[model samples]
Target: MDGTVDITMPAELEGTRAVVRSWLKSVGETVRRDEPLVELETDKVTTEVPAPADGVLLEILLERDAEAEPGALLGRLGARAAEPAAPTAEPEVCSRQSAAPAPPALEQVREHRLSPAVRRAVGQHGVDISVIRGTGRDGRITRADVDALVAARASAPASGSRIVPHDRMRRLIADNMLASVTTAPHVTAVFEADFSAIIAHRAKHKAAYERDGVSLTYTAYIVAACVAAMRAVPVINSRWHADHLEIFEDVNIGIGTALGDKGLVVPIVHRAQELSLQAIAARLHDLTARARSGQLKAADMKDGSFTISNHGVSGSLVATPIIIQQPQSAILGVGKLEKRVVVREVGGVDTIQIRPMAFVSLTIDHRVVDGHQTNAWLTAFVQALESFGD
Candidate 1:
């Protein structure tokens, strides 16, 4: 006796919604247990759902581009050599399965990966897409992929003009950015932070941290500073609701990791308030490596309460209004770390000094917090960095 295994959408989707991006295995195709059976795309990330058991794909409940709620049935896998009964689930999808539903058309499945942005660009520009090669994920076309072609056609193109587009990811990121700026009243407050103490601490412990397999990153210190700031202004670690404010006790910090020209992903270091400096560094190292290699899971990008954008790594001195991630009240932006001339009081005497410093800014949703709270948070954050013990 053999029973069908249910394959369903993941219950803990970041946004509680997903679209069936593609069916990796067709109905009637034999698959191994744990094999990737389908792909689902949420606004946060795209993830592959695996087969529940070794069996033949007996039915597809959700076709490509169909919306799915958490735990909605995606398909059914029947035990090999046993024909399962017509699944009582979503019978409407049965039409896709006739007596012998044909596998998805090769071109249709591939073309579906092109985002509406790409489609619109193709129509708007009237460029022959066939001649241009795709540089996006899996070699799919992207708006950036299309733009480079148009730029090449121009009479004179500037240096470093091409941008890499990773199709769906880029499109979703753009939409979220547009919505955030439109919905939230953004206000940014800038401050200068002295990292002299942190630099000294790292220099002393870097070798020891390396021995323990941790990189002892500056980000670890930044995260610790953020937690300290959260204590000073708890509202910084909160979300805005129409009726009230929802402040969280846990400081889940999302570190914005850039992937060269492919944009960035924010992987949260959950409950940062409880993590030690070494532990924070370790997690950042792992999450960042995985992010760049395309190995991060959907869960890695979920449930962020606050975010930190270390934009300084790319050489920018500062970026104002680094758009706040929606729902979250604020985002901390760290600019390029460079030594500069400054005035310091030493033994009650003020004198000129050269110190390593970085410009930091807190971009907040004015509806959620006021300047007093924003400035208070930045002051606390800088104090944490400057007051690091020798």
Candidate 2:
């Protein structure tokens, strides 16, 4: 007898909805039980749905980027079977010379000729193309036309990109980043913090922390500082909604991890506000290592109330990081940590001394967070860093 068979969205996994991020199998492919079948993405995470049983994939019910609810059948799995009989109903034939519909008539008819790219962009922008002036031959709307109108009447020069193929993750990143930039009126505030205290704290704890399996890096300190900072400046943890501002009480910070040549992934640390400094360090290390090794799950990237990009890992002194807009109002960028000489007053005597310092930039959505609030948060963040006991 054939084995019992059924497919399901991954359980206990965040974002199991059938918005496709990747497909691990093709139709007619024999898949083993527990093997990944398709990768699904939520706004902030990507996860794979595994095959339900060892069987031949008989049918794919959904295409990539198709939306599906949890527990919806994504495909059928069973032994290969012969083709079934066609429907017995007489095939309806339509005349090619049918009269063109009026504007009202066309409104009811679904147009299927839209290219995938155009469809995606239009759906994403929620654009009403009927109002756009088309420049294509015969007034057919083109992708370029949609893009041009999306960038309409902008004082700043349009950002250009040479067309290049991107994998699913990169594509998602592109879409989200573009959406954030377009939707949010971003304003970046810069802060220069003396890192001497942070250096002393790390130096004092580094050895013991490492012995306990923690890296004891500046990231943990920053994470703690950011948690305190977010609590102090609650506006930084808010999003602008259609009719109101949504404030998030828990701080889930997304740590931006670079994925070598593919792109970057920001795996979130849920409730970073609740995690201790050591716990944050341990989680950050694990996530970063796994992220680089491509072992991260979709849940690791979901539900971020804020983002932290440690661009300083590559020696960048300071950067105006872009905010990931959605349920988050801002992103904090950490620049390279280095020792530099600066003037200091010691016991009323002015002297030059070398001390560790790093630059931080908080890019916030101006619609939700003002510059004064952003600056206040950064100041509080620096104060937190300066207060870390050695």
Candidate 3:
């Protein structure tokens, strides 16, 4: 007995209007249950749609580069055969000279081993499969490996001015950034933060954290502080609807990660208000590592109420009016940390001191967050950083 299964676009991809990047299987090809059958590329991420059951691919409703929406039928799968069928007729013999040439061993391997997406990429790039190395399981060539090769080839074009084509991710990022800047009346408030306490605490606890396989960084402290600040000024962690402002009870902090020319991705730390400093550090480390390796899931990039852009990692001193992540009312930017001389009154005597400091800026949607509220959040964030031990 045989049954047919409809392969539809996932519900999570409702709004992305993803395009069929590549099909990993062809009609008549055997497919295993849960095996990926196609690759979908959205503005935000690239994901695979897997088979519903062990079966043979019967049809492809949408071919490569076709646009798809949520619940759109992509293909059909035919139920597995119960048993091998006996030969119905004898084969006719042919002379060796009249026979068709056999496909190369590499081509044969690729047909069976590579996904439709990877195969399409390999063909489009005209890559010499014989020389390319595979990093996937059992030495299978993956889409990422092919993309990396394509990128490398395009890296040094003619040594002159060139027009670089933006990938889907880059184009989507640009569209979102433009939409954000245009939609929100961005207001920026800059504050000087004293990180001496945080620096001291991390220096003392860094070794212990390393022993536990986590690199305790300043961003962890900032995320903790952001949580505290959001508690104090909940409006900072809110979304702006046309009719009203929606404040969330839990803080979902989106940490902005740069992917070189590929643009940025913000993997959220859900319910951040409940996490301890160490837990936040561990989660951030995992998310960051996964993000860079293209292992982040769709859920990792959703429902972020607020965002933190730690531009300091790349030595940015200060960036004003950093566009707020859409719907979210505000985004915090941390600038480069540096030692600066400051005046302080010690026991009624004026004293000059050198302190580690960073400039923190909050870019808020003026419609939702007022100047007073912005100041309150920044004050709490700075206080948390400065009073680390306490």
Candidate 4:
């Protein structure tokens, strides 16, 4: 059988239009089985369309930067060159009138080898797979490679004014943020929290935590406090369903990690309420590390009942009305920790004291949470931090 195959888009990219970023293999070039033939970029990720079988690229139906839908034929491949037929003795008119069967249509197959994260990155950037230096086993492309490419592109200085295109992640983040604000009436309640106790506790246990290979950060303490608060007020750990509110039994906290100009990703710590302070610290450390390294799995970003954006890491003083992650009732925003003067009563005399303090804000979905509930959650959070022991 003459081995001719049609290269189509992967099924995972359904419902999305991808731009033909670039072709790694030109027509007449031989492509090995599973070798990348072309790069397709979508809004969510950039990925390569691999050759189904060992063959030579025979034709290209879509050129670079052309828009294509899922299952659209991008090109064709031939297993081998067609053999020449024997000379026919029939007249030219008789040969023109001869009936012959049409060739069979090529089968449509989806690429099943790419990981979800890698696929997302591919569709997002329309990356040129050939240009990427893969560090994975067997020379496979990983999300980190795509991120490196993105970072390099971002860092390069442009010679003139140019419009930079948004990757899939950025576009999705924008759409989600816009939807969150439009879907729910957001109200933020700010509270000044004394972090002296938590800070002292961390300092005291820092040695032991480091010995155990965990860096005890203030964010861990905040997350532990959030778990306590969530247990006390389950509504804060709930989602707003169309007909009713659904409070989850387990607290899955999403810690927002900023990816420079790439946007943000919220990787969740599942069953956070069941974990101890040390466990929470270790897990948060792992998740954040993986998040920044572009190693987070799809599950790492799922089932988040609550989200915490610790904007303070970047020296943000305070962020008001931080948009609540959709479906979740609220999001916690922690500001930079600093020393501040406070008035205290000592032996019935007014005394001034410097304390480590941070401003905490809780932005809630008014549709599922009320002002009283918001205040209650913040109170519990603050109390946990102030009275923190061990």
Candidate 5:
């Protein structure tokens, strides 16, 4: 008897809880090696598990909505077996089929080229693209086209309101946010930081960094400054505990990357204190690109002592009491940088001039640090940015 191949979740998943969203093939279905077999959703991204070998799906060990972690078994395959036994257990969803009618011949070919959203909607609702009028330019099919089709397929929602269920990712984010708020006493201190020196520095080297294939962003400068500030106030890179505060020697900084309607993910720049500005930018670029593309591994989001939320990119001037990532003592929120008038002295004369400025706030867990320490950390952080290239 040939041994069975286990279809398990990959071990490299990090930071957030993961759960099964759906399975691609039902038990007893023939599948090829490396085919996408199941969809797994995490707090940050949705990924697929591939079949280990050419075989029949012999077991459905875990069903949809079940929590799955590294090495957790999802199902099994009877490798190299032409005939496999029936599944011992299966969910009712296994026998369910899409309600929509089959698409036209041309539409069957078009299915291969639809956007991810369209493809998903088409699969779930058995959408017939032949009926969905394209609203995109040049008669292209947009995600909205499939969406409208899906909406048309459903009956009118009561009171003109449609019900949208929370996805696994959204639910995970909600639980984490609620738990963090309840567990940690969040206190915020706002401080203004002048970015003239760093702005000048970025202006000088940004093109060169780009030539080397790295995007030199102000956030990289902020991360470097945060590392410097950590040196001045190590307690800021710490965790709160009932018995004792845990301060980490390594400065792994997690930057909050928003995913719009999908919530947000924090991908850590591991050992940030040890990396140079350019290195920090490169790591951040890689992590952020992967984050947007749903490609970050669990290790990329793990082991952060502190976090930074650059909400200014989204046009916010300032956001107070930005929720801290639990187990982290503090989080830094950098606001929008803009030109502002300020008094300056030149040649023994007082003059008004426009300077680049931003509000940098530090939100700390009271259990880990007090006001003095929080302000001290922000002071150091501001100094690092303002004093750069001087």
Candidate 6:
């Protein structure tokens, strides 16, 4: 007298397929209709999948941190009554986990909660789970935990065969790279900017800025410059839609942050055009810290007008960064700041002096923008940084 209900993937998120970040309901747990059963996450968003009907969870079709496609069966819901199947309803059946599924080895079981990234890393690296010690909150396993185990084993000259599995993020990153390369015809433009004025400005006011409880950084300077440039050349803040182009009026900048081995996340600084330099610095600090902590919300990744990846933070001289290919036209990258000597006209005479400078690279969808517009945006950005006063 039991009937099965299927949980189908939502349509709007077809391109943005979901991954099981966490499973809230387990087998045999009775769930209410529309109750959240699992958490799904993409690179840009995370959301919950609701129950198909009021029933008991019979089986989880996928494991935690597994990839799910749109319209794919997430899990099975079993009802006590053999209710008549409604028209246009799809029958849910559990797919074979493997042709010959076997229970996992005892060593495969973990004693502590492992975050999705850690779990995926362990699977990919084929690390022995028994030796990993969790250092995260509540002794939860982290990516560092897995890496430490791998390093220790490697240093010990350990000899053991293991099969690892790639986590959902790695898989997603792979698919994303493929889709982006295939979909977007990318073009890049590089230019160097003099940061003498901005550096002097920071040196002159950084202490007072800190006194106001704000950390003054070159990032704030870049954000301010980007805001001015976007205002002057709005086309750089646009998106390409089929048959037409869509331009965003407000400027929200997405900052690419590397969370070490955990992975990369871009937390958007909302309404950046409306904030002062100090305010932008404060918010950038907050968003980046949260992003590194894996605490960013789904809404934080939504609606970015443009993106900035400060690759120079890691000492890169320059990088042709890949675009996030969102509802945006372009992404800008800032390289390492280094002191270089350049000629300047001083007192109507040529002079050679050292100045802190950086290379800026902009990657845009060339189909929507041209070289002139791209360079113009970069020119305005450089001008703003050079002209800002303390």
Best by TM-score: 3
- Which is better, 3 or 6, measured by lDDT? 3
lDDT of 3 by residue, 291-326 (tens): 777777777888999999999889999998788889
For lDDT, candidate 4 versus 6, the one ahead is: 4
Looking at model 4, residue 161 earns an lDDT score of 52
Highest lDDT model number: 3
Worst 10 residues of 2 by lDDT: 106-115
- The residue pairs found clashing in candidate 5 are 14-298
Q: For residues 1-390, could you state the per-residue lDDT of candidate 4 as single tens digits?
A: 266898998776666657776676668877788987787765334567789888888999998768887689999999855548988898556576788967544211122444455667778888766576553333456555577687778766776554445555576678888999999999999999998898789889999999999989988998999988987789989988889888899999989888787678788989998999999999988988876665565557767889999998899879988998887889999999999999989999999999988899999998888999899999999999999886
Sort the predicted structures by lDDT, highest score first. Answer: 3, 1, 5, 4, 6, 2
Off-target runs (Cα >4 Å) in candidate 5 are 14-16, 81-110, 113-159, 347-349
List the candidate 1 regions with Cα displacement exceeding 4 Å: 82-166
Task: Tell how far residue 186 is off in model 5, in angstroms.
Answer: 0.8
In model 1, what lDDT does residue 374 have? 96
Report the error of model 5 at residue 1, Å: 9.6
| lDDT string, candidate 2, 18-114, tens digits | 3754355667767778776775655434555788778887777776667767666677898645458999998888789988766744422223434
Which scores better on TM-score, 2 or 3? 3
Summarize candidate 6's per-residue lDDT along 1-390 as a digit string, tens digits: 157988766554575657766666667777788776776768644556788789888888887667878677778888844458778967887677747667676555553345345666878999767765443433345564576567656666346664334444556667776776666778889989999899889999889878887888888899999999998889988888899988887898988888665457677888888999899989987787667655666667767888898999999988875665555778899999999999989999999998888999889888788999999999999999899895
Candidate ranking under TM-score, highest first, comes to 3, 5, 1, 2, 6, 4
At residue 229, candidate 4 shows an lDDT of: 94
